[model samples]
Target chain A: MKKNASLTRLFWTSFSISALTFGGGYVIVSLLRKQFVDKHGWMTDDEMLDILAISQSCPGVIAVNATFMAGYRLRGAAGAAAAVIGCIIPPFGIIFGLSFFYTAVKDSPAVRGVFRGLLAGVAAVIADVVVTMTTPVIKAKKVLPIVIMFAAFVANFVFNWNPAFIILFTAALGIALQLARFFRRKMAQGTGDR
Target chain B: MKYLELFWAFFKVGLMSFGGGYAAMPLVQTQIVEELGWINMTDFTDMLAISQMTPGPISINLSTFVGARMGNLLGATAAMLGCIVPSCVIMLILTRLYRKFRTLETVQCVLAVLKPATLSMIAASGGSLFLLSVFGGEPRDLWLAGFDWRAGFDWFAAVIFAVGLVLLRIKRVKVPPVLIMLGAGVLGLVFSVLPAVNG
Candidate 1:
């Protein structure tokens, strides 16, 4: 099929994107948008956002999951495989190579110093992560979401609750709220009909 | 047998880490540090720093490092596969049902809740990491032992942390994070050598 030829192109594109980006999910995402939307004109911004939402909703790395979604959307199962493998291979290979020499390099005083310095930098980046991640939630100005966000933080940091349990509880809470809203809307429609 | 253990451990981490890599840190910490005892606290933090510098998901990068440390190339392969397979399979299945689920009001609400919850988890992870880096990764008992809390703290790290916060958060410096990290590493090298010279 003609799709098969495109699949190889898709794979290499994903691989190059993954290989070049250094900052992780957010960086990779923006690069993906550029290639798929601006350069190739294959996907619209809204479609990309929708795919990103699906990727974030699932459990995997956002990069890998997005690659899978984009690949599947373009050319189906085989395409998905190509894209996922292409994206992951570079990072996997690099990290694998580094692992072999990590012990040797890690033992040096200078290396230890560098890693120690990295600790502060990591802290700063994480602090930014907190700010960026929470900004949208706060801007939404929804009381329930605001409350849930703080509650989750306290439960996690202060109580050391299992993250899985916290996620489950929030999911249940969301479902309950949605169910109640749905029933209320139905009741209102029923009254109008009568 | 060890390879199997590495696979299963990372597999659970892959399946359960909901928000993303940062949110997964706590679970990864517990698994690798507490349960498996594969690495110590210091090494874990070092791995985190290294993983951040690497491309891809932090989880995958970490799995690769941990696996290689345990069993060379074969171990690394196992860990990497374990970390990803669950997600790959789940995504494949979900991709099929995605059209139906995306339209559901319940699914929307669930995602809405998950976004804030996941953000909160990331915040908490940041807090714990800050404490660990500043306090030298000792258990709480050591901190509570007496009034000599300074004994357990790493003042160098604490100072660097404050400087970094000021540079990025308050000054709104447009520097990339990797650059900042590298600068701090340079500072670390200088400081390490300084003590040797002075003492």
Candidate 2:
């Protein structure tokens, strides 16, 4: 029972993190790192990173995955459920209201202008996020991902290639690389055993 | 044929989305445009542009727009429902289980890969968005190119972008999205009211 209470607190903490973060997942991550990994001593940085990767590959919202992984890490499947719900309820409630009146808001001049202004700010935020995220890849000496990033940028921006194709292709490449590396290690281990 | 399949497809999308709503673009484009064939490439592109120009998360906007396009009001409703349901349900479940495994190392490894991938995907989507915003129509002639760039980079947008960035950097103020959006709308109203700008 004591364990369950603590788990609930962590879930709510994550939920609050998601609910309050202005810029979405990446910002949420920084916040989670501070609150969960640093302040609370809940999870290590590496564990957070791993869950983030899995969440990306998986077929759901990143926030939900983070919540699930954080929860599961703490208390198994049931904890996972609690964190997921906590993260989602706020956004769902907000979006539901927005959806109903979105058309009406669209016609308002004031609303339209604000969005235009927000677009530029959003662009800047995205630029900041890109820089922050790429730091790790730069440090890791992995040129392939960087090259892929540049190629993707040019393909979508200059060549007008379909983004869907680029994503699918790169994901396949990542998976293939992982699998090949696994086989090579296995083969080396087999030789060593022999 | 099956509503459940439709629900699951979107639910999967909603659950894995990270970085932001834009991160879901490639997945959505793949699922709906390529695999499902529910929307054509052209329409999907069009919807993307519309979603960008409008306020709100691109994914939700696209879901609503596409849902309406695909199956009318109900379809829009279904798609929206499909998108939100998984996150809602899952979050509820996780809220209960969060504390026990908070210190687990295994969980962190998966997040590391996902974080970068999600970032890359968002960047990729940003590229697509730039194209949609700037170059979606018939190819502009050389003479028209200058005009488009000049007109498209409106002063209102530029000013707001600059101010927002400064605020973000210096003050570290977290400007609410709603307020920024509303500010833009007010500027538009001002422009509309001004004869010179309106023309």
Which candidate has the highest TM-score of all? 1
Candidate 2 regions off by >4 Å? A1-17, A29-59, A73-75, A135-141, A179-194, B1-22, B26-121, B128-153, B162-196
DockQ, all models: 0.63, 0.21
Please give me the DockQ of candidate 1 compared with the native complex.
0.63
Candidate 1 per-residue lDDT, tens place, B1-199, comes to 9999989888887876766677667777778886678998778888888888877767778888888888998899898888888778887887888777567678788888887887877777677677777875433433354646566578888888888876777544567777778788888888777765311
* Weakest ten-residue segment in model 1 chain A by summed lDDT: A1-10
The CAPRI class of candidate 1 is medium
lDDT of 2 at A153: 63
How accurate locally is residue B68 in candidate 1, as Cα lDDT from 0 to 100?
88
lDDT of 2 at B51: 52
TM-scores of the candidates in the order shown:
0.89, 0.64
TM-score of chain B of each: 0.86, 0.60
Question: Across residues A1-194, which tens digit of lDDT does each residue of candidate 1 receive?
Answer: 22333877888989999887777776887788788777777677877787777777777677887888888878789988998898889888998888767787887887888878888789888898788778887898999889999999888777777666787788889899899998998999989963
Cα lDDT of model 2 by residue, B47-140, tens digit: 5544544433445556767666555556666776677666546544544544433443433433434445556666765544333333332222
